[model samples]
Target: MRIFPARLPDCLILQPQRYQDNRGFFQETFRAADYAKAGISEPLVQDNWSRSVKGVLRGMHFQRLAPQGKMVSVLRGEIYDVAVDIRPGSASFGQWQGLVLSEHNGHQLWLPPGFAHGFLVLSDVADVIYKTSAYYQADDEGSFCCFSAALNIDWPVTDVIRSAKDAGAPDFSTVFP
Candidate 1:
């Protein structure tokens, strides 16, 4: 796997080495040794998957007390995925990076703790899967409005379907403070 750094300090774009044949293809999505060699030592505690239709947006979410470090990928279709740096005292604080992920490319992103994660479905439907370093804690969960002016994210989709909680998330101006 090739690990490439994104604009954010700890965020990474992971490109797997795919072995393809007429029959199919195989790749090691996650290998401890490879990750450890790259200086990533986060311990994954949970895996989650979600399916969303085109124009659906989810997140900008994180857990303040138990921030999650996520290894994210798409199982089907495609999306515009983004991660924002929210770590206090970090030089990249409030900065964000985006990438286009699809089943065809077989690429993924690793977003370390102290970042907010979100995605916009770009195909007819998209299946997103991820492993998290921490377990979900309801009380610790928090989100910033995906369209908050302060965030200034350039979402590719004009029409978006969002969860009630996500739609009502505090704006970055309020949430970041």
Candidate 2:
């Protein structure tokens, strides 16, 4: 497995080595020892999975009081995934990194705590799975609009589908004081 840092150095793009044969393929998606080497000492306590159709956009979301670092991967389709730095006082604060993740690429994105995560489904349907360092706490939820003017993210999609919560997220400030 190899790891490359994204534009935001704290975030990483992980390439897991896949050994393929006539029968199928094998690879280690996550190994505590290997992850520890990458400075991810937190124990991933929850694994969440979601499926969305094309044009669906979710997030720019995070947990404020109990921030959760995430390792995101796509299992069945493709998505334009993004991570934004919202950490106070950090050099890269307000910066973001976006990339395509799909089953074909066999890539995983790692977003450390203090970053907001979002993705737009590019395929007919997408199945995404992520492991979080901390269990989810509804009361701690935080969200920023994927299209917030302050961030001015250049989202590749035009016809977008978002929940009311995500639509209202634009009213929230991306910059933490």
Candidate 3:
């Protein structure tokens, strides 16, 4: 596995080495030791998956009480994955980073705790899967508007499919400090 560092500390883009033959291809998606070696100390506890069509946008979401650290990857098709550093006292606070993740790329993005995560579908249909270090809590849930000017995330698609809850999510200025 090749672990590439992202702009934010503790965040990484991990690419697995694939071995292909006439039959097909083989790759190990995750290995505890390899993650440990990469300095990812968080122990993943829950796994989640979502399917989205082209132009669908899912987040800019996080939890205040139990902010989940996620390892996200595309299972089918592709997406523009994004993470915003929201740690109140961190140097990268309010800063964001993005990457294009596709099934062909075999890459995963690790978003440590204290960050907000979201993604936009870049293909006809995309299946996104991820592991989280924390279980979800409704009361802890919060989100910033996907296109909030304060963060200025450049969502690739102009027309984004969003849930009413997400569409009504508070802007960062109102919720985040």
Candidate 4:
């Protein structure tokens, strides 16, 4: 597997080696030793999955108390995934990065703790699976509006569909300031 750093450096894109034959293909999604060698030593403690339809947007979300470090991949269809640097004292604080992830690419993204993550479905439907370093904590959850003017995410679509919770999230300035 080859790991490429995203624009933020700490965020990474992992491209797994695929072995193909007449039948189909196989790839090792994760290997503990290899991951540790790559500097990702977090012990993934939880896994979560979600399915969304075209135009659906989720997140700009993060956990404050027990922040999660996630390894996210698309199992079916495609999405424009995004991560924002929310670490209080980091050099890239408040900055964001985006990437196109799909089943065909066999690529996965890693967003370490101190980042907010979200995605917009680009295909008719998308199934996303993610491994997290921490378990979910409802009371510790936090989010910023996807369209927050301060963050200025250049989302590909204008007709976004979002949950009431996401739509009601505070702006970036309100969250950080």
**Stretches > 4 Å off in candidate 2:** 172-177
- The stretch of ten residues in a row with the least summed lDDT in candidate 2 is 168-177
Show pairs that collide, candidate 4. none
Q: Candidate 3's residue-wise lDDT over 14-75, tens digit each?
A: 99889999998998987989988988899999989899999899988998988999999888
Per-residue lDDT value at 9 in model 4: 62
lDDT of each: 0.90, 0.88, 0.90, 0.93
- Work out the TM-score per prediction: 0.96, 0.94, 0.97, 0.97
Question: Model 1, 30-134: lDDT tens per residue?
Answer: 787887777779998899999999999999899899899999989899999999999999998888888899998999898888999999999999999999999
lDDT of 2 at 34: 80
Candidate 1: misplaced stretches above 4 Å? none
In candidate 2, position 167 carries an lDDT of 82
Task: Judging by TM-score against the true structure, name the best candidate.
Answer: 4
Residue 86 error, candidate 1, Å: 0.8
Worst 10 residues of 4 by lDDT: 29-38
